[model samples]
Target chain A: MSRARNIEALKNILIVVLFLTTILLLYFLWENVTMKTFRLSSILPAGSSHSLRAEDVTRPEEIVFSFGAGGVTADPDVDGRYWELWMNAFQKYCGRGELLAEEISRAQFLQLTDYRAVFCRFAYDLPLESFCQQRGISNRGLNQIACVTEMGYSAGSPESVFLYDGRSGRCYRLVSELPAEGFEEIIRAAEQGEYLVYYGAASLFGAESSAVLPLNYSSTLAETPCGAELGGADDAERKAIAEQFFGADFGFVRRIEESQGSLIYMYGYDQKTLTFAADGSMVYREALNGEAGARRDYFEALQDALDFIENYGGWREEQGRHLQLRVRDAYEIESDRQKGYRFVFGVGLEGVPLYGGDGNLLTVEIYGRQVTAYRRCLPDGDLEKWKEDREKEAFSVVGLLSEGYPAIYEALRGEAPPPVPPEGEEAPQEGAFEWVAARLQNARPGLVRDAEREGSLRPAWVLCVDDCDFFYDLYSGEAFGAVPRQKD
Target chain B: MKKVIMALVLVLTLLCGSCFVCAASDPAVTVVNPQGNSTVYADNILISVKVTATRVLKITVFEEKLLNEDGSLSSLDSLEALGQVTAGSLRHVVVSPAETFYSNGNLSFYTKELKGITPGIYKLRVTTLDENGRTQYLQECYVVVRPPSEAKALSFQSEQSGVLSFLQSFLKNIFGN
Candidate 1:
């Protein structure tokens, strides 16, 4: 009787297994019959990668508006609402531009961007070829300067367009016969928007200076929800990105877990090894296995890098934040694989740029015809919505330094303040602030992500002084931290 | 009752701050802060004024003492005027009494910064001159100062409808802000 009972149980288990197999088979058959174009391999990211245009990759870092006499304003919008409208309209005029001047006088260039003008600034030099392609203009003799660091259009002088090359500090001019009604409309809208137009840097110190001190101590700045981070992510949660990277090959990819919660995934014969570090950074390194296919120019190489970025993970636009890759720099580098260019990018939210601890969103190395390396360091989710908050006060360059004054004054001066009246005195004066402000190479507002805090981001003013980068809270004017300035 | 009255006055002042219009019609000069005899705790004050005189030629901005030492609020104005912010050329981020300021053409904006003042009621004066060298318009806003540590609230209460903004900035001041 016992044997019979055991046999019955075994028979029941087999029947259940058979039913499961049949259901799976039926589902597969149904899928095949209903969706002929669908295949398991089609789900791979490389098969239908994200597609983007050259114009989408290279964008201005800031849209600086000179309102009145030395009243410059950079308005940070929640969504990149109308920046593209201005940029696209500005590009339409560049196509018909005729070479006006190779080298514009310093006074002339400053005059163009000084008042009633719109200056589109790039964090790094924009390749002339890429810029031309982006605007759909022929590269032609536009190579007078290898790169365009900044460009502008003065409503006051609609007949002429200004181009700035940061490398040479030389300005170029382009003349167009087209009407500048588009730019005028954009400018009029921004002007009428009632932006907080502060006294410009030129008003505080001198012309063509980036250092700015608030002329009015009681003035206020706005605070925006910059960026966000994910916390308490488990190993499986972090490995999810690795799976997307491997795509069709994810099943076969060898995943090696490292100490301190690091994850490494090696794809087929060491072709590519991706690392997800504990610091929420992801790096993709392609092994130098294939033969040198073909050498290409920077433009073609950039396209390839963009293609790879889309295939693996898009600019996170699908997430609805309109996140785009704003290229900060392009450098000629030689790796063991081959000599190629490295494109460094910072993630841009709408039009505003959010810089990380290292201020790098992504770095891709294109060797010959292939992308040899790629690095990504951002919060877990690209399109994260920080809690909605109203605008807060922004810290001025002078105010920010004042928060850490005297303490940093000694470091800034490399000595104590001279004794006034009696001995044992180390009192800094306005002159000390003036001294530091003069040395400030540049100051701009953006969001800062603290790497150690797992993506805790805050709105801050990023300042470069004496080869160092300092971040101050946008509202409280408190110092977040400072790191060595990364030379482009 | 005294604390409640002070709170109520502060609330009213902040609500009406953005559109504070006191001067005459010709130039329409409006003061932004230190309304008459308002109390504040800050190291420096900005003589920000809005003028409607389109034909203004020159504008001179400065500050003057409104109260003598040993005044009621003067004792509370114990903050060191010559702060590092002035010394380092850095400006401190001071919460404005007004919640929201909309700019059209009447906004003259921030014109001058006055630093290193001893605690007392001080007057921020803006003298606007027309095409001629003569003074065309003048704006004066009086503010009382106290030590930063003596302040009771993170910021003044506003009647403006920006409740989210008020809560955001206030929470920022008290929290990990």
Candidate 2:
């Protein structure tokens, strides 16, 4: 009887050992510890081709360095390393910082950024969580905030960073425990640097002046010259870009020239198409024939877009002009009942925008981590002269609109929206500059293709009155072009 | 007591007459743009000024050609005229706050554009007086200018908050509350 019992116990021990071994194997697979060899599929785009990170494409539309007392360095890129240095430092210091005010009133928001600080304004709103993740910032209640349109660090409150939500009009502050070395470096640069200074509209106009947002802007813009950056791109370059899309299967792709002078390269049963237009624009589109897939987050969609652009032709500056793209707009797009996102990027030289065309340099649509559409309209610009001492003339927003109102009024059909008077005040007299003074919804200085002067790029003050955009000569304040605001 | 009261009334009237001769700081007149000492990023500068004055005012911008040909200081006293603004026609209203007091007041807005200027520190002095011909004083402020932004279509940001108040209003012509 004892021998029989011993045999049974041995069997039970073996069974326990086998159960433990099974669990260990399942754990390794679940954690992807052993699947690391297969993880390349997840990181790389389809067909094991292409490389890009979110940081490569994400950039602030413009950076403003406030030196207190209404002194600001907007577009603080004078061919200096300030833009990159400030961007890196702000991210490094504010990541994982504590939240001081989860949300602040508009009054406090304005006050926080009004003083000595470096603020980055984005053309497109960033999902704060995705932003924090991309910047590698983890904790301190940053997740509570939904979106961040602008981020800045105030010298007055050195311990904190302020975030403004342009959409919700909400403000939040994230505090840092350790001293911000990056912020200090920027402060040192602003104090000791020979940067350009612009007065805020608030400083020039009354607080009630609704001329410009953030009220921290100069009405005038520096004038620079630009010519075609990619006007000389030949068929060889276009073919090379197309090859990047089809990879080693270029010979297998069917090429067709459209009646509109655009050459289309179709890959296998219309799975994808690449078009090279006579105007030197290239577009790559994917057929979205699959069923609606689960929508991915904005970060994933953005990453896919970045990877797609990087793989096709490239996103870096073409020619010597540093043609980088910055996010201008993002929206939920649907096709055939399939949900996805469309990201529009404004092309610029050395991080500044190129203001003509469809107002977008690149547009990409992504669904379920797959990019379905990509468009690249590289500027045909010669920016070498602009790289020189570019500030020639400037006109204040009032100056631009004062002389520009008649044309502006006529261009926009004499219905330019006037600034609403403060409550308890009578409406402004229907005549006089009441039509334009301090009523500018926006005033931006940027590079535009001079329609009058062919093959030349001239600086302009792109003023937005109501939803209509009026491009005026930065020096003369003469109307350049006007168009209705493109809906996001 | 009656004689003393009569003498005080006579003194008050005299003081009131003196005040009208010069509006002084009350109902102040201030310069709006090119806040003094401010720097310009561009080689060309426009001495733009936005002034909202209660009385008729003269806006003059003097470019202190502080820099010589060698780019050194030129004794800071040379006031080279950059631009000036004077309106020929302006509307005004007569207001009576206390009995027997009628003042011609106007809330007029004036702005002047600056001319071509290179990178240099300019001490611009602005002199203005109401119809009373009040004496002027000096106030310091700074403002700067930079290149045009017509490069790329900029993403628009049209709402922020409070503005920098009346850029360096050298003399405040406080008309009303």
Compute the interface RMSD for each candidate structure.
23.7, 17.8
Tens-digit per-residue lDDT, A231-314, candidate 1: 344555445556656667877889798878777899987798987766656788887645746557777777888877766645
Docking class of 1: incorrect
TM-score of chain A of each: 0.72, 0.70
lDDT tens string, model 1, B80-168?
23111122332222232322222333223434555555455443444555545565444544456655435442111221334554444
Whole-model alpha-carbon lDDT for candidate 2: 0.54
Among residues 3 or more apart in sequence or in different chains, the pairs in candidate 1 whose N, CA or C atoms overlap within 3 Å are A221-A394, A223-A392, A398-B90, A398-B91, A399-B90, A399-B91, A429-B87, A433-B88, A433-B89
Q: For residue A167, give model 1's deviation from the true position in Å.
A: 2.1
Tell how far residue B68 is off in model 2, in angstroms. Answer: 38
- Candidate 2 C-alpha lDDT tens digits along A1-488: 99999999999999999999989787565533443222333335653543455665566666677655444556625354666786677667755544333455655555544556787776657877776666676644454456787887776566667788765667766555556668757756766866555544444544323233322233323444443334465555555556667777887999898798778899988888987766555778888867537778787788777776655655444335466556667767787777888887766665445665334457788888667877776565435566444334465555555455656666555565554344335555453344444445556776766645653556667776655667877666667677553432
Best by lDDT: 1
